[model samples]
Target: MKAVSELLKKHDGTLWHVTPAMTVFEAVEQLARLEVGALLVMDGDRLAGVFSERDYTRKITLLGRNSRETLVSEIMTANVITVNATTRTRECMSLMSARKIRHLPVVEGERVLGMISIRDIMDDIISDHEHTIASLESYIQS
Candidate 1:
């Protein structure tokens, strides 16, 4: 299995994020502008939390809170599940599946690298399978 580092290399290297003090409305706008499902909540250089569409839907919409007034820090998922560059893509997939999470931040020590989505894991798995199938077919032809 390819390491998460490989996937990171393939990415555009954009660490989409927002400040914890930002309003949910502002954060949501950033999410839409970046075309991402989640945004890493940064408290200066520290990784504070993660704000996602699910957070907005469950905490704001269901609770009848005002997104314009509510802070991202108030509703963001603070206990973030992260992976290091050395972690395998398969492991990331398993973690996401078990946690019912769609996004995972890649970190090293306390420094955040980037984020990966379930889509990234799926693409890696699919690509690996296709490569394996082609190799098998080539072997048979030989």
Candidate 2:
């Protein structure tokens, strides 16, 4: 099975992070500008937590809280579930499904490496299916 390490190899090896003290508004703006759905909240190189669009919607918007006043750390999901680059795609998919989360931070050692989404896993599944079909067709032709 292909591992996350193989998939992460295509990414730019960049991890976008924000400080815990940043306001929810700032985090949302950064996420929008970056065209990303999540950001890692760093407490001086430590994975303090994770901020996601859902966090904004549920904790800030739905609750009628001011994004400007609300801190990202207040609503961010702490103790996040992370996977290493060497983790199998199946395992990653399983974790996402079990946790009902769409994003996962890829880590190596104590540093965040990159982020992977459900879309990335889905793309891998589609590619594998296509390859299998191609191989089957070749076998039938032979």
Candidate 1 ranges with C-alpha deviation above 4 Å = none
Q: lDDT at 25 for candidate 1?
A: 99
Q: How many pairs of residues in model 2 come into backbone collision?
A: 0
Scored by Cα lDDT, where does model 2 land? 0.90
**Each prediction's TM-score against the native?**
0.97, 0.94
Tell me the tens digit of each residue's lDDT in model 1 across 39-120.
8999987899999999999999999999999999999999999999999999999999999999999999999988889988
For model 1, name the residue pairs that clash: none
Report the Cα lDDT for candidate 1: 0.93
In terms of lDDT, the poorest run of 10 residues in model 1 is 7-16
Query: Best candidate per TM-score, number?
Result: 1
True-structure Cα RMSD, model 1 = 0.8
